[model samples]
Target: MPPRPRRRPSDRTTRARLASVLALCLVAVGSTSTLPPASAHEGAADPAHAYYGILGANALDLTTLTGTGVTAVSLEVGWDRLEPQRGRVDPVYAAQVAGRAEQIRAAGLDVILDAGLQYPPSWVFDVGGDTRFVNQYGDVWQGQVGARVPDAVFNPRVRRAQNRYLHRLSAVLDDGPIAAIRVGGLWYNELHYPPATVGDHRNSLWAFSPTAQAQSPVPGYRPGQGTTEETAAFLTWYLEEINDYGMWQLRHYRRAFGWRPTLQLLLPGWGVRPGDVDKAVAGGLRGATRGELTGALNEGLDWAGLLPRAATVRGHNEAYTTWVDAADQGTDPVYESPVRHLVRLAEPLGLPVAGENTGTNSPEEMQRSVDRVHELGLTGLVWMNAAQLQDGRWATLDDYRRLLAP
Candidate 1:
């Protein structure tokens, strides 16, 4: 009898082997690509010589802020106030915003225009209902920071409307005081969905709109179906959606302003408990993260994708770090510190990293925060609100001013 022919591998087995090899090759390529080049920007920024910036119009008080040596200010430009009606912006409100930007510039301070999409007009709910995101529990996520917002970033209709608003804002402001635009009104002026607090009835996971579902890679996915695998997939998708929205705003800014003004993505700059993220995954990813989670594909900001889209990435974490230290929370210093991770994320992208004081840091914590910024050579430092500059806190602002002064 003829020798039996050798058994052939099944098509499925052959395909699996090929796929594994292909994945390994891709991983190798990706790993090599992310390595820092000669002369990374992370250590290039000198916090000692960095610009001292402040958030809000409190810095607009030129006499007081200038006296403290502030060089920049961040202004919150409200979307609802600017365009309360669809296809039309209130002339008075628009003028007020434009005037504010101009005044900040005339005062010889760099201005960062914070246009938060979270401040959508009321009509948005009615007109763009299809784009609104329904959470796993079949409830729409709304009333974020007291404003009703949809998962509008990825929605085509919403993006178009927002693009129009940005254009109008640019036309009115005329590129005078605008040094940068920090986009995002998600929650607390940072990125990510609403809180996934335990026992809360509201759903924190979003972008479950028909549009989002249609674009979703996961087929037949439903909310509240808590499974680790499914939750992980959703988290990955949601991060991409965030990246898309960020890139969208950057593009719109360029179109309107005829120049790519520095685009900043304000991040919490704190770390979320992995256990909390795990719980959120079980709760349909209720947009949970303690700080800027950037390592693996979990429920955190996708800094790998976002840092490239932004010219500047600012984190609000130093005060939290101070609180944790003061309270003896025993948090990991490296994990809690946004400077190390931000420098790592932004260095390859050549983006400047900035930090904001939470207005709660003690004098000692303030010094540590400034020291970290200086060590990392961060681009700038901004005090969160007016409180840091008022009363006896004037010395606090003055300290940062002198430290950051070139």
Candidate 2:
């Protein structure tokens, strides 16, 4: 039989057909086999919450955050951008920051101003170039090999330069609406030296300069790559110097602000792996497991010494790497608490703790991370790089808003 010539469908009919296909696709995606059942207790919106905020880059839209129950905004002011010249603060950049802070304050939202010390003005490196950290290979640590921060934190000259910027910054942003200031300049945005290797790329050990060598607590300490003890001592010296630098920055901020606003120091949540340090050290790194190594290696944080100096301490954990969703980890807080160890240390000191999930985190992961903050009884949760949420992560955002609501 001859096939009947098919008639062209009308525009209305085509539109209806397309709609039907889309509806069916949505139904298929929503089928029980594809999605877990929504639980009543999972992520209900709460109306009362202490503080729900978002972290952003320059020029945040205050309206968007204010409407979403965000009580605070956290942003960074790069030293490299504001004070490229050694000991000279840029007035233009200062005004820009002050203006933005004023706008955020006018909107009735608290502000957290972070000034990075690790990534400092290039000229500072030039001024103290000889003091830049030296790696195991005697190679001067530069940004190229993960040795970014000039290893001059221990130098009095560098400290004076840092304080000068702080003094100038406080003067410019004077009387602006800043609720707190986070002082940190570690490589990954918290307090820590750059790792020995950033993925397959081996980096040199830092602070091997003659100045650092002379200041080392362990005499005859060589910075070159060697056995476990050398690495351990070098790591210890690095921690002590950085921790001291962190405290130094905190004290200067306190003096500049006159205790008008809270100051925060962020400590990385390296994890809670309690074990024997001597055993871990005696056993070479290859023999020492990750758990043993974490406990022994992380002693550098010395939160006991640093946390007391700040008004409040916030733990910043990279969720993409540190947190696993409850669904994936059987709803265990152990799997979810990125800063469990930090929380333990902060709680006893009567320090109110806040948390943040930085970098790229999936919407589902974001929900779990936010929930973990409250579950741990921390003060608040700030989601970093809020611009990344525009890609239909509102469902996740809404869940966070509800979870954070009182």
Candidate 3:
């Protein structure tokens, strides 16, 4: 077993409070803060209880993973496929999910339902309450994903549909051999804004949607377009909304799924070009407007703000399962803890943390990820794939097997 991860000192007292914030920004959303803690995950941080698994275990030979120290499958059961209509839960599709779970259980593995809530249905956009995400250029994004995903985080009509889907889907899997539900977000299953690849590329802000603007903290202020203080205040509100979106789902899942299975998330790595998440406040990301910090800012993530808030969800059973991979030994400070950063932030919060390698990185890079998975006393690691093993990228599957083996 790996040594448990340790947390470093951080100032929890520091926050930039801008007085110009309006009252409308305080819109009350769902609350998990009141739920009594029921997700004790048995061996959350205990190193001896570490688990090893495959994410898309259904794709590659299941037999290859069955007896190889792997015990779980992180399956992305897309919402669009399950509930294609607004108020209906497709019986045939629901049965298909149960069958898939049974099949994995039959293989001697448990299933972690990756709640693909990000998979919006066609009918939802039709019910439109400014349901699409409008970038600054007014380019309404349906995301690169094939679904007509909605701006559910800010759009109440869309969120109500998503809420219904969550409750329905959770009730379907509530009594099964499911292990946990990885609370997904608006695309890629990671909680963040869709890559705003307009003029400035991924640096574009996505909070310009009509529902978003009507709800902005300051009526006329836009992120990066206002005074420096106004930009800071707007950025703060934007990040908080993103954080609340995550909590809203976690709370909704707990209500429908009950406290049986742990509710978790798959967060992306810090993707800014300059790499310092601190630059989110003061740095260069010059776009059509100035003060634009990409990555965490545009992406709507800041684990410093997120991890602490996550722990409040049903007390400790919430986890941090990685949907990210390592490009090298994350030991390279230049990479700024790109891989282990989330793990470190979450460790102190007592939220169970884990790892995942997309299997698309270089063999050496993947090998380093395996090293971190084994080294960090995380809940466990899930290989989100294995086409690498199939395509002869590694000399053999044993490259992964041995690291997993005692």
Candidate 4:
């Protein structure tokens, strides 16, 4: 070939651009930045100690939570947020959520994801409708608290849809990189009343969904007319279903990441009895003989056996000292040491447990509650309402961090 004339600088510039474009393509195809390592509590050198966090940004100011030297971040994700419409997940929200998880992981902090089914979509309820009670606000002050019914939980069609939604969420987050997962929170609030009630209505809130009610396997059992035995059976089935769902998520996460994520149960209102231990014992088992019902209603359910492999079980004790102080009027010895009974109920579970909402606003209350938690060998404690952190009333975040330090 004949010698070619020298090319112009413009031709050289074009070649350089082509080379840069090829390099960018290769970088996008082959190279990937590794996600920061997750910091889980179970794998820590000191398993007994744990730093507490809050439920999403609502529980605490995000700015403060990140700056507080917290090792973990807990947040509640609602069903509505996960799947707003049928089979249509919001990619924007999902990306934002995943980004938050990635950010927490990047910061070398753990993330706890809490999910719940109590709140139904607004479309499920209507004014003067049979399922109006499904709405969060249903005339609280008046004697009429609405019907307290949501067709979604009980309806088979809705249940299937909800289950599918859960599966989609699992698929999205399984590889998104998070530490812990709390599959339940105040789960029984709408299912069962605070104290044991006689009617099946209280126990069958899940039946509010027509689809669930229709597909219910129990024969000859009307939704509201079912007896306590029938209700118990229904709850057993429901809880088993939920447990399976949780296990499915855990398995998916493990299959995707080759490591089991922490599982947790966030109980509503501490899951503890309010009055004296003897009174609670009696109240929990009204008609049954002594020793029939444990001091707490939850103790009667044998949750530990149902979800034996859960990594953590956190209770919410909003008024610990207030309840204890009120119960002090009794001369009964059982009332004097309610914490002892509380600890006894949780000891056999063999999993890390914590108090999510400690009612220790005062120094004395904080000290007493901390002493009781330590005496019981509980894992740790988390205070609700991060705004209180700056109040300087009880143990602040710094104080709790120090107390839980390894």
Candidate 5:
């Protein structure tokens, strides 16, 4: 889970961490160069068969996993953590990834790469043309950890360098028994812009880059302060720009891994709005959309425009939605899961949508996630941090076993 920013006093109960995501099947599973040929035979297991996923594999003694039917493990490819320098991946991080991959494969589980570009190296900050993402407050988000979200949409060199990093990292993995790779930018391995509530700034919009400002539909337009028509126009561009970033990564992922593995596009907790639904209708996606689009314009998420492109990416793709918000936020009016709405959008296009819980710390929370997963008929539910299962206080191993049992 991405760290939550301090909230404004008036922003009580709002799902401020829009980057925490809703969930997704997160990259479909297909016959890849690394996998055994038997998994691909006709009438064998479906190519997209894995349901359960664990995000942090190294944190746990994965060899102990069994009987809970955990099918997939997420390989964290944090850019800074992987590539401390520019030319190649940090060998230590690559070795850790490889070791964890072997543990996951030994447990008869699949592997998925949750590629995160949040923590760019020092050189990435100087890649090209003011490459760091600037929020509405002129706060250029940068750090060695999860702080540096790049303006890749505006800087082509940043995209090239990032993809080159991905290609290099993939080579280090050396085509192991991997099922999928979840491609994302911004934060938390999910494709989203920076959150709105970064240290009590409620009016956070991430379109202040030099090129973003130059390409603005309504120059000098602040969100919600402009005319309704101007807001819509700016928002359309904002969301489409984010979608363009998503598409660019998808193209890179295809080129990086070729047609061997499937891909998943992650959408954060931007609840779908009636306007989005109206657009969905206009675009012939569905009769309606689901959930109100919370932090939609601020987060630069245009689900109506983004989902179709993701579902059609290179044939086999999954709509990865995050369901932790609805479970965590409970009845909070501001937070919602677009799972049902995503189902409306994804199913019509034959796309498989799945989810992941931000964290299932307690039995109650785990049960809530499980209940929603069953209710929505999601492809599967991924437990975000497997290490949490070892702690006996919140949720024990048995608790996760019970909560996640198929």
Candidate 6:
């Protein structure tokens, strides 16, 4: 996760060539070159889509991921991990990432990198003084407050720094070898919660900072105070900020390289209802729960709309079965409306839609989910938590490979 180490003079040129090739590939795919259309191949045919990769939780268990015949790996690389201190990167972590990337490539697998914002460096928090109730580590502190937490993605200063960080990170791997770049995550995590609970014990409120608050475009907004109308406006503005940040990154990759990498958005969980212990859940209509709403957000994105431009639009479908099966015990109509809407959404964009963080372990449930995916005409699927493979709960990597086999 650290910045790549200094290289020998000869290696520097080699790295540059590698970076150039990656940039060229992106450009060719995005530009009006006479190259074949991006979607000409199916997910099964694309080497990048062959094996469903796990997230950071599973990636930490390298032995399991590698042994399960996983053809690709995806993990959250925190900003702290890449640059632990102010402007200082650990060379060892960089080498490890590079080494692992090569290993995966050598084994004929793919690598999807996630540069995340959740775990930023400690210095970032001290800049405007931790005003949010929740700290960066997701903990709530009593009687400690300051200016509102800064929305790093929207703050010009923070945004510029983030862009630089990503550019450098990409430069390191662009030439070295990797499959795709995940430019976003569960971006809605911070925006949807009420401002009063911004740093509450349950919600991750402390994650916000004064810088984000001061730079907010919303008028007369304070760190922990806002009227209902102001709250709604702030939420809308924040969502736009997230969308803009993502689009900006996408555009940069397209303009600089000629092809935009894939974009992924994490769907919220089904833990929205009271008494739900899981953090993944969110509430929905008619007691439907968060899973349905999560799918709805994906539908709203019109994921298919990115086909002509983006290489892929992946949904981190975290709540697919968690809430569905939970509600199956009762006759809640088990509405398929969200899935139906998703199908309609994808039909026009002509881009491939995929589930990237499906955590279901039951074979029956997994198969049912797969059926839903097929019903909605999704192009690919990636199951999270590779350790589940050893437990014999979820389908093994071979199972997914077979599903995607030619």
Q: Number of the top candidate by TM-score? A: 3
- Point out where model 1 deviates above 4 Å: 1-42, 58-60, 144-147, 175-177, 198-203, 222-232, 269-300, 308-336, 391-395, 401-406
Clashing pairs in 3: none
Better of 1 and 6 by lDDT: 1
Instruction: Please give the lDDT score for candidate 2.
Output: 0.53
Q: Answer with 2 or 6, whichever has the higher lDDT.
A: 2
Per-candidate TM equals: 0.72, 0.72, 0.79, 0.54, 0.78, 0.58
Candidate 3: segments with Cα more than 4 A from true spot: 1-46, 59-61, 146-148, 199-202, 271-294, 315-324, 327-335, 386-388, 394-396
Candidate 3 lDDT at 168 equals: 86
lDDT tens string, model 3, 1-406? 1111111111111101110111111222112233222222223355556766665544555677754777787666767778886678888878777777777777888787776766666788877678888876677876455234688778888778877887787777755756777775666566777653554544667778778888887656644455666666767787788888888877887777777776667666443322333344453233322113223467676667877888888733644635334332223222323445555556667777776654444556556665655455567767645554566654246666776677
Better of 1 and 4 by TM-score: 1
For 269-309, candidate 1 gives per-residue lDDT tens digits of 23332243454566564432222122122224556556665
- Tell me each candidate's RMSD, in Å, in order: 15.5, 14.6, 10.8, 21.7, 9.7, 14.6
Per lDDT, the best of the predicted structures is 5
RMSD of 2: 14.6
Sort by lDDT, best first: what order?
5, 3, 1, 2, 6, 4
The TM-score of candidate 6 is 0.58
Give the whole-model CA lDDT for all candidates, comma-separated: 0.55, 0.53, 0.60, 0.40, 0.62, 0.41
3 or 5: which has the higher TM-score?
3
lDDT of 5: 0.62
Task: For candidate 2, give the lDDT of residue 158.
Answer: 68
Which scores better on lDDT, 1 or 5?
5
